[model samples]
Target: MPTVPPTPSPEVITYTVRAGDALAKIAAQFGTTVEEIVEANEIEDANRIEVGQVLVIPQGAEIPILCPILWPLTMAPTRC
Candidate 1:
């Protein structure tokens, strides 16, 4: 019997925060919301994103893994 391939999942985008970059702007650029970005990134302060900070931008309902260099430690895995 012929086997079927698995469906492709939504892509996870990683963005590096730039100077004067805000959650709102980033969300708009990525076609997402600030709240979603905050939750996906586990950001303590949505307004406190640092320059060069890497962020995970989930395309759909699935959340991807966080950036490894977030804190120089092993970051815990989270579900979608």
Candidate 2:
């Protein structure tokens, strides 16, 4: 019998609140909806988040951010 490979777990991202960041915008940036973030964070109200709050961005389903390379030209075409 052949062994099967296990699926990888989703990764979580975090974002800090800026001076003018709203829940809707934050969700949009993560390709999700504000309601989803609220539900994930157990926020009772969607409009009551405070500034400088460190919210756990539920980007489990979204693509990860690629780090900037010091030598962009050295990167493979497929990676670029």
Candidate 3:
């Protein structure tokens, strides 16, 4: 049986930079890593964010919730 993969969530949030804000600090506050934020916003310098700069905070990749009733018996169980 062929199994269909789950689609990624499109949810994202925006954050405004405040005084003394850093990539690391902002990442920590949002429960995400600095690298993820940088990749999402295409930031050239992780240390160069300015006050009032709007940042796209990519929430952690969500684990797809599987419903057994929706899946076929021949399909393997999802790791999630």
lDDT of 2 by residue, 12-75 (tens): 7787888888999888778888988887889988888889888887756464466666654654
Q: For residues 1-80, what per-residue lDDT tens digits would candidate 3 score against the true structure?
A: 99999998777788899998999988877778899999999999998999999999886634334445645555666553
Report lDDT per candidate. Answer: 0.81, 0.79, 0.82
Q: Per-prediction TM-score, please?
A: 0.65, 0.65, 0.61
Error of 2 at 64 (Å): 6.3
Compute the lDDT of residue 29 as modeled in candidate 2: 78
Clashes of each: 0, 0, 0
Alpha-carbon runs more than 4 Å astray in model 1: 1-4, 61-80
